[model samples]
Structure formats: structure tokens, C-alpha cells
Target: MSGNARPSLTMKSRCLLTHRAMYGAEQLGSLPCVLHTIDMLIRDDVIWLFWFDHQGVIQSFGVKFVQHTPMFLLVLMALQRFNTANWGLPNGLPHGAPADEFVKLEELTAEHSTSDSQSSSISVNWSARTCRSLHFVGRCTQIFDALVRRRDAAVAKLSFPDVSRVSEAVIVQRAREVQTAKFDLQRHLPVLHFVADVRPQMSAIREFLNITTDACVARLTIWEKLTPIVHLRGADFRRCWFELIHAHHLLWNHGIRHLDPSAANMMVRYVGGASRCPQ
Candidate 1:
């Protein structure tokens, strides 16, 4: 809700207002959602939401306020096609998204099932991309691949079983690295994403309809569940510093820049009873 809104808005009013746009992202596969009050961006009043399937599992969503349409869906898949080497904490889309082999490309999952039939892959055919932005198509094949798209591919690689076959020490190190990647993916990355517009409606239009907005594009990102960073203590806290450094280099060299990182945005990821911190 905007601060200058003529009439103060209720939460339900806000939720109802945004629901159609959020639900339009049919590929996210989330169940019905309820808007929550965890304010994310003050400038756009972007907040959080909770989604629950029939079985009652919780899925979290955070809204990223932006003006232009995000091109992550294109840029990330292109990166996977261009890059040959895999980063330690794989850019999350992990093994990679092939531009041509669009079929069975695997939607992201922390479970990292080696079997292909388990998940649905995101696909875009020539005809489907007709309405997309020209810049989006150009960047998808050129430099500056969508940083957020890079996130999904990064997440796909997390939790992957390290297949390194060397000395016992090397094997042990690689396994730890895999654990760290999975922990970081859940703690720091956006696993699922979609864009929506949340602009204002004219008074007359509002009275008759619920489906109009301008170009105030916002990207809603869903992430793995996380624990508060406050849970880290003593040795756990100190160890987190090193892990954060490792995660940073992996992301920076591979092409994702985390602009605003702080304790407020960081989380404590526990894997096998150890606090795995990804800054």
C-alpha cells in the first residue's frame, strides 16, 4: 500500500488487490496464499506472504519492488548454456539450464533428486517469447544474464552430491562443500520467482473491476525456509564468518551481487546439527 493512498487500506484489501497478479505466475506451483505483514521494502511497501498446500506445509514469499520487468527467466537459462565450469556453491540452477534441451530441464529443488521425472521444468518456446521484451531476449543471449535467473540455476546445484573421486581428505572436503552449498542456497537465495505489477487503479475502474494496474513491476520471490541468525553462538558464530566468505566468492565470481546484506537479512542454516551461516 502506498503512503499517499487517499483512504487507508486494510490488509485484506491489500491482499485482495494483489492476489490476481501473484496468482498469475502459474509456474510457481504454490497453493493458496495469505499476505503477511513482514515489511520488506519501505519504498514500495512490499511485504511477505505464506502459502499452504492441502497437507499444511508452509512456503514463504518475499516481494521485491522494482519498476522494470525482471528478465531472470531468460538470463539465468542463458548463463547455464554459456558457462562450462561449475562453481563450488553452484549458481543454484546447478547442473544448468540448456537453451535447446528445454525438455526435462528440472525445476529447482533442495532434494536434488538425480532422477529426472520428479520435477517440472520451466520452458519457453519461440512463439511464447513473442510478447517478451526485446531487451530481455537480447540480454538472455548476451552479457548480464538476469542475476535472479542465475539464482534458480544456483539453487538447482545446491544439495548436489559431490562426485569428486580423489584422496579421502579431498572427498571429505568436497562433501563439506556440498553441505555448505545446500545450506547457503536455503539461507541466501531465491529459489522461485515471478513478476507482478502493483500500481493504482482509477476510482471509477476500482468500483467495477479488480484487474488493472500500470508499470509498477514487482518481483515476488519464494525461498527455502530459514532460521533466524540470532541462533548462532560462540564457535558457531565464528565459523559462520568463514562460510560467509566462501559463499561470497562463489557468488561474486559467478556473477550475482548481493547489494544489501546485513544481520537483518542473513539466516542461520542448520545441517546435521551444525549452524551453517551463508552471508
Candidate 2:
């Protein structure tokens, strides 16, 4: 594949959704099985996950994918190789994706259809045996329909100008400045978190973020979610800075230098309680 041409798992029908109450708490921890399921949903541009009860009714569980830095894969690999011995899992890897976890990937299927403006009215068709299982446990039909409705709504509300000629640096710079805290308000929408129709200067760059939008969304708002007056000691900041430098160095080694390193780009979501490190 080209540098920008990513080879993604197009269709992952087998996705196991284990019942939390049925299985013991210990068996319920890691969820590697969800990766395949998440991959399928993301590939189809379905942004959220909706879980239902045994009665085939939708319940409260809903999940949205978060995007990470461009070098997230490299950072994940390094963290796994260096810190997995001390930490439970690498930072960027899915919460439940581990061999020792013994999580089983479940299969899901649903009925869906593709429509064109010039074609006849929307014709319904049952998805293949593979795609039907997702709709079974998750109410795939409802979820898929929700996606279409949201997409159309977005189209109707679209007012931004085309941005195909802008550089990644420019777009990144603009997105970082978006500091609004409202959940549904308009602001500088980070490319990592939300998808926009702006035209990209580089096709590969567009494809890069577009393809991985689901995974990197969290990193965009993590810092914002922390306490406004987070009380980090001088030493904690130093340690985080050190890790940031290390992450940047790794990227440099890969020939991808991030020209700008603003507060927005450096992520600080540690797993444990706040620590006091020696200055």
C-alpha cells in the first residue's frame, strides 16, 4: 500500500458481544473481541455502538471512536514493547485486545442497501450471512438507519466552505484553536475527532485521517475533559514532557516530523491516580 493508501479490514462480521452479568467479573475485563466488531462499524461509517437487551430492545450502552496522533501506531508499539511488563496494556491499544485476555471475536449481521440519486427508490435488501449478525444483538438496522439520518442531517446543516486546497498544517493549526466546551455547538472541530467535508491539500492526508477517524477522536478532547485547574506538580509535567519528547523522537526516526508541537498535540491521559514525582 502507498504511504497514504491504508489497507483496512473492510468487513468484519464476526464480533462477539459478551454479556457482562452472565460472565464472571474476571472473565469480563478485556474485550479484544470488540475490535473486529468496531472495525466493521467504523468501515461502514457507523460512528457509535448501541447495545440492546435480551428482549431485542435497545439499551443504554453507546460508544464513539476517538482518533489519536498520526504516529499512534508507532507509539502503541513502543509502549507495548517497553511498558507492558509494568502497565496492563499499551495506551493506544483497544481496552480489551490481548491474547491473554482470551476475548472471543463475535459475529454480527444486518440488512442494508446502497442507493444512488439517479437510481430508483431505496430498495431494501438483507445483508449477506456475514453482515446480518451485527444487527441481531445490536439492533443493526436501527443503528444503520440512525447513521443515515445523522448523515443527511449533517448535509442539510452544512454551511462551511470547501477546503480541499488547504495544507494539513493549516487545518491542524485551525482545529487546535477550537476551544469550545459545548458538546453540540459549532467551534473549531478537530480533524482528529470530527469528520468534515473540507477538501484537503493532499489526498493521502485526507484519507489518512478519514480512514482512522474512529480511533483518534478521544485524544482530541482528553485534555479538555480533565479538571480545569489540574494540579500537576513540576515533576509530573517534566515526566510528561519527557514522554512527549520520546514520542516525537520516535516520529522523527520514522521521517515524519510534526512541525508544530502545541498544547493540543501533546496528550496527557495517564491511567493511574495523580502521582508526585521528584523534581
Candidate 3:
């Protein structure tokens, strides 16, 4: 396929094509079976089994595949949403945000972009930049918090392995530790309190805190990686398709079978006229 050519297939057609490219033509009939297996893995919490097996008993290609599949699906969903938006389709972004809120977000992004080109001088308008940065960070935290809550609820329903053979005291302690590690609104209260109490003398400390918080937030929002696809040219998209093909071959070389391979599970990063799989 030529790099500059638009993908001729509709989404459904592209899905099938990508699957065929990943798993080979003979394995197409097994796609449904693969998907069912992945569903069971997610529902049963088998992804965690590998971690608990200290002797590497469950550390196999299949176990690694199961553990990674959830993240793969997340990336795929993000890509599909980006592509939908790129095609001028309804993006299905969260609908409850007021129009004014979106306008504010756009305004912030515009101002941020404008600031990037200005000279790095002490005269720079740091106060406006700081406020914009804080607003963006807060919005990101809210989104991340929502995602974490939903995940925690789903995880609560999942069936973990029976540890009844272990002491009840140990299990209870472990459970408490896990709960404490989980992110909740209460965990961020101190940081929020500090930001709200900003003092002139604490400018350096506040900047440090902002940088730390931004780094943490960025780590939690891998879905943002998909946004680049919205700006990709037709040639870059085609290159991405080829990169997915290469990824399939690479997996095969390592004797790893991506049974549920599909367009949604494959992600391509485009940079400097080249394309590569994020995985």
C-alpha cells in the first residue's frame, strides 16, 4: 500500500484486515474464541496470577499476553475515538460538560501554545501561565479520579484466587495495604490544600510541587498518546498500518501468539516520518 493513500476500507473492514494481518489468514476463524478467552481472563482477575507466582510458575507468554491485553484494549479504544473524531463523526466525549467549560479549556490550550513561542526571559508572565497550568492539571486529576473509581468498582466484583489456605490475619493486612495504595480523593487533599494557600515566599516550592504533580498525572494518562493520530497525514496512517504488521511479525519471532489481534489492540506511534508500535 502507498503511504499517501487513504485507507479504503470502512472501520469494520479495516478491523478484519488488521486481524488477518496479525494472526494470519488460517487463524481468522479462531478470533471469536480468542476474544472469549480474553473476557474470561479479565473477569477472573487471572492477570494478577503471574504476579503472585513467586517461582515464575505462571510466567509464560500467554500469561504476559493476558496481563497486557487490558492496556492494549484501552489504547485501541482511544485510537478508535481519535479516528472517529478525525473523520468528523460524533466523538462521544463525555456529554455533561457545559459549553462554557469547553470554551475555557480551548482558551487555555490556545494561551499555552502561544506562550511556547515567547522568549525565555524573567519578564515572562509566569502568573497567568501558572494559573493555566494548575487548571489543566486539576481537570486531568478529575478525569483520572473518575477512571480510578470505576476501575476499583469493577475490580471489587472480579474473582481473586482463593487464599483461604493462607492465614486470615495475613490476608486482612494485605487487603488493607492494597486499599491504602489505591488512589482516592482524600489522598490528594494535602496537595490541593497547599496549592490553595500559595504565598509569595513559597513560589519555588509551589513550582516544584506543580512539576511533580504534572509528572504523576502524565503517567496516569497514557490515553493521551492517541491524540497524535488526529493530526496524522494519510501517509503517516499508512505507515502506522505497516508498523502494526511489523509488530505482529516481531511477536511471532518471539513465539508469542497475540490470539486476539485486531486493529483496536494495535497502536502506532508516528514521529519524524517514521512509525513504530508503542508496545
lDDT of 3 by residue, 1-279 (tens): 123332234566446544433333122112111000111122232221111110111111222334457665764575567442232111122222223221111101111112222111101111111111111112212111111112211000001112222322232223333322232312111111000100111123225435321111111111212223334468876765565555545545545445655665554444465654443
User: Cα deviation in Å at residue 249, candidate 1?
Assistant: 2.8
Q: What is the C-alpha lDDT profile of model 2 across 1-279, one tens digit per residue?
A: 133333232224213223322221222123211211111123332232322221122222222223323344554465457443123222322343333221111111111112221112211111111121232222121101101212221110111112333433344444444343432212212222122221112123225435332111101010011211135457777665565555445445545456765554444432366642111
Instruction: Compose the digit string of candidate 1's lDDT tens values, residues 149-199.
Output: 232321111110112212222322333344343544435432232211111
TM-score of each: 0.28, 0.22, 0.21
- The numbered model that scores best in lDDT is 1
Worst 10 residues of 3 by lDDT: 189-198
- What local lDDT score does residue 232 receive in model 1, on the 0 to 100 scale? 76
Cα lDDT of candidate 2 equals 0.27
**For model 2, where is the 10-residue window of minimal lDDT?**
214-223
Give the number of colliding residue pairs in candidate 2: 26
